[model samples]
Target: MSKVPRVGIGVIIKMGRKVLLLKRKGAHGEGTWAFFGGHLKFNESLEEGAKREVEEETGVLIKNIRAATFTNDIFPKEKKHYITLFVIADFAGGTLPIKEPQYVEKLEWFMWGKFPKPLFTPVANLIKKGFNPFKV
Candidate 1:
């Protein structure tokens, strides 16, 4: 079997001590609440892809992105896997999109200790580890 490495990006944007979250609409981790992000395209660097995704999905421009955390999702029994890089950044754009394709059901900031349970797997673990990218 061959192992596939997928590069993705997530942001931890804080507003007055609150973090942003979006409810997934479709695809992996659908129906769960997670950070705003997506897969990296062929010609894009991780940071570039991260910035693009964050803006495209939320219409929010991320500035001063800092490495946060790395996560590995491996389902050996089922031969499924994913490696994700999480980055923390500051949100500096107008209000978020309230539509499909980018169909984030809801957007809200929440206190760290009061975040909801059953968060998207990668995100939940990253948050649990305190968002340190190089740790992985």
Candidate 2:
């Protein structure tokens, strides 16, 4: 494992009381539910990274993007660590997320208190921290 940890950005796109979740297949959090996001590219602003990731992964757009919360995640089994920055935004409009057959099993909307089981560890950590994306 590298001595340095990576930085990941997760975009929490909230619509009404729902949030978007992608079922991961062949990634670190395989077989778990996670937000649509990836690592922050070099020299990219947080907001830029968030917008870029969402578009790249889902081909969807968002508006009123804003910083939300973060989590410090460590996965000993995978021998990885990440400083997870989360941002909340509203779905702007465009093509909805693709199923991403290669890695994503499904793209689904879930109510705030009705997240699917076996959440990605990072996302589960957020809930453990008492995170409520709907908070002002």
Candidate 3:
């Protein structure tokens, strides 16, 4: 049987003109910049999962969470598929720290239209579709 697609939530915490991004350093999407996020926990709502992921990964609290867009991410080489929900939110509080060094290399703020390359597949796909969280 083929593996099923997992559900994920990507949080874009906006601070004025910039959004938070992290360089991934794990099995999937290594060397690519991505928004803070992770797999959704069972029975967790999308908003809850987004908040949890952002806080867990970057130690940043977010609020005013809203659904921005989504993408169907399929990594055939990795044998992984995911339906990722993209959320736009405001940075509420908390210090930004590299909480999970195992999965992330570094965190930085990038202007919306000036993102660094190479971006994670899902984020790149979203950008290609003209999905702008800031405009939502």
Q: Write one digit per residue (lDDT tens) for candidate 3, span 1-136.
A: 1478988788888999899999999759999999988999999988999988887887788899998889999888888899999999998888978888999999899998699999999999889999877787
lDDT of each: 0.71, 0.88, 0.88
lDDT digits (tens) for residues 81-119 of candidate 1: 667777777777777775345457788887765677668
Cα distance off (Å), candidate 2, residue 10? 0.6
What local lDDT score does residue 53 receive in model 1, on the 0 to 100 scale?
Answer: 75
Model 2, span 1-136: residue lDDT tens: 6589899999899878899999988888899999988899999998999898888777778999899889988999899999999999898877775736677888888998699899998899999999998876
Clashes of each: 3, 0, 0
Q: How close is candidate 3 to the true structure, as a TM-score?
A: 0.95
Q: What are the clashing pairs of model 3?
A: none
**C-alpha TM-scores of all predictions:** 0.81, 0.94, 0.95
Off by over 4 Å in 3: none
Q: Best by lDDT, which number?
A: 3
Better of 1 and 3 by lDDT: 3
Q: What 10-residue stretch in candidate 1 is worst by lDDT?
A: 127-136
lDDT computed for candidate 1: 0.71
